[model samples]
Target: MEPPSTCPPDLDGPTIDIVVADPGWHRLIPNAGTIVRRAAHAAGMEGTIVLSSNRVVRGLNGRHRGKNKPTNVLTYEHPAPEIILALGVVRAEAAAQGRRPAHHLAHLVVHGALHLNGEDHDHPGDARRMEMAESRILHRIGVPNPWKRA
Candidate 1:
């Protein structure tokens, strides 16, 4: 993995726990815990962030989202707030979008955090608002807006 990416210093916010369920995550993004904490804090969320494999994520997706495919990220609110990310899917998407894997991972973490906080992109208006919030949060944490075209 590339050297751990730099992130702003931690600030006062909700406490978050990061669980690296898959060792492969280290090969995709170094210092992932820092990224997840910063992004989750910026999104004003507190929860467990699970860095998992594609197979595990696919099973969760199929059971929860009704799609038998590995998604970049997924968030759950029941029992406790939790966000799951698939390393392979995240890395591939980052490569496809020509973005640094760390940046994409941060974006998805923030996205999942927003979802847990009641930000939904199911409709166009909602999507715009959610994207704007994401851009704001990402910018605060030094990541470029994912919605902005290069």
Candidate 2:
């Protein structure tokens, strides 16, 4: 297993940002953030990893993507000026899925962090690489392969 990257004086590893105004967002922010931050750390990203959720599904749908009463998870990730790993999780969907909010949160966190680290699944080959990487990362951290369960 790759060792967690060290934080150099000139480099920062993922910073967390919480932007969800909805009071109903997950209480386990730290839990999810820790999982994602560690994963990003393992991936060798030298930046801040922000953790947050969203509520304006309409605006998100129009700006970010999709408009189907929101989604269980969404991540807006990019490099430069610090990476924004926005995680928007629909609380109702989590409840409907009978998942512990924390699990869903952890999954989204890893997913977003991976994106910031340049991992993508836009195509079959890319997806396979991402899923395989995610599976290995999640497994190492004791979380089941999220895609495998889904």
Candidate 3:
């Protein structure tokens, strides 16, 4: 898909190179790159987001995070900034939260982009700040706050 001509001017949007490794997910998310780019722009970051399957994300989580489990999203920042979103986890979380899958995906993209930009939740104070930033970014894009209780 082509990039949007009118992105927010305050931030230099990222060149989001997206790779949809899952055919089913490709069909599920039509404009995945656009979503990633907008989220990155909101976070004032530049990166890549790979919309992948559960297995690929699980392997990445295990190798990188040492969790040995599938996760909704993973961010890498050393070699290059990149975010990986697992379709399976995203879909499930969205459903559980009664939110549209696309909205949840966008939230995760923003969360991952923030991580790429040095935002972390390792401590309570840092996590609160990160969550506030995520909420603000998502709100700017008209997405509901993901942290709000149901």
Candidate 4:
């Protein structure tokens, strides 16, 4: 998802704040705080977080599309004067995909942070770049490569 250009160009703070929300599937996920903080740090962002847990029936991956049902992970950005990362994840979706919710959440947080910095994946090339970057970052933290391209 693209960052919403709601942030004004001028703000007093030189730091970007991180806001995290639990998307309502605690049953499937854990260690949300550490995951979110790690993402913010990986993206070179510093600040407060105002995150929320959400319920997403529509799968953002569209992997199953009109067939299998929604899968985990969604990124929303409120761009600007003070950047905000709106990271959403479907805990159930993660479980259904055989993914750990914490891992999925971390991926989305990083993805959301990238959007705030103008990274996009609408095209194959862009997605590849994003995936590679994600793979590298996750690797640094001892997480397996998250990129399907690899």
Error of 3 at 126 (Å): 1.3
Better model by TM-score: candidate 2 vs candidate 4 = 4
TM-score of candidate 3 relative to the true fold: 0.85
Point out the worst 10-residue segment of candidate 2 by lDDT: 1-10
RMSD of 2: 7.9
Q: Compute the lDDT for candidate 3.
A: 0.80
| TM-score between model 2 and native | 0.59
- Write the residue-wise lDDT of candidate 3 on 1-150 in tens digits: 332222223334446666666766656666655676777777777756777789988999899889889999988887888888898999899999999887898899888888887889999999999999999999998889999987
The order of the candidates by lDDT, greatest first, is 1, 3, 2, 4
- Candidate 2 per-residue lDDT over residues 42-93, each given as its tens digit: 5455455433334454455556665644444444544442333233453454
Query: Which residue runs of candidate 4 sit more than 4 Å off their true CA positions?
Result: 1-28, 47-50, 55-89, 148-150
Which whole-number lDDT from 0 to 100 does residue 39 have in model 4? Answer: 65
lDDT of 3 at 148: 95
Give Cα-based local distance difference scores for all models: 0.87, 0.53, 0.80, 0.52
List, residue by residue over 9-124, the lDDT tens digit for candidate 1.
44667767787888777767778878888888888888788888899999999998899999999899999999999999999999999999999999999999989989999999
Report the number of the highest-lDDT candidate.
1
RMSD of each: 4.4, 7.9, 4.8, 8.2
Clashing pairs in 3: none
Please provide, for model 4 over 11-129, each residue's C-alpha lDDT reduced to its tens digit, 9 standing for 90 to 100: 43334444333333233444555565666567655444444433232433343245333323334444432322223434554566676667766666666666666788999999989
What's the count of clashing pairs in each model shown? 0, 10, 0, 11
Error of 2 at 101 (Å): 2.0
**Model 1 / residue 131 / CA error / Å:** 0.5
lDDT of 1: 0.87
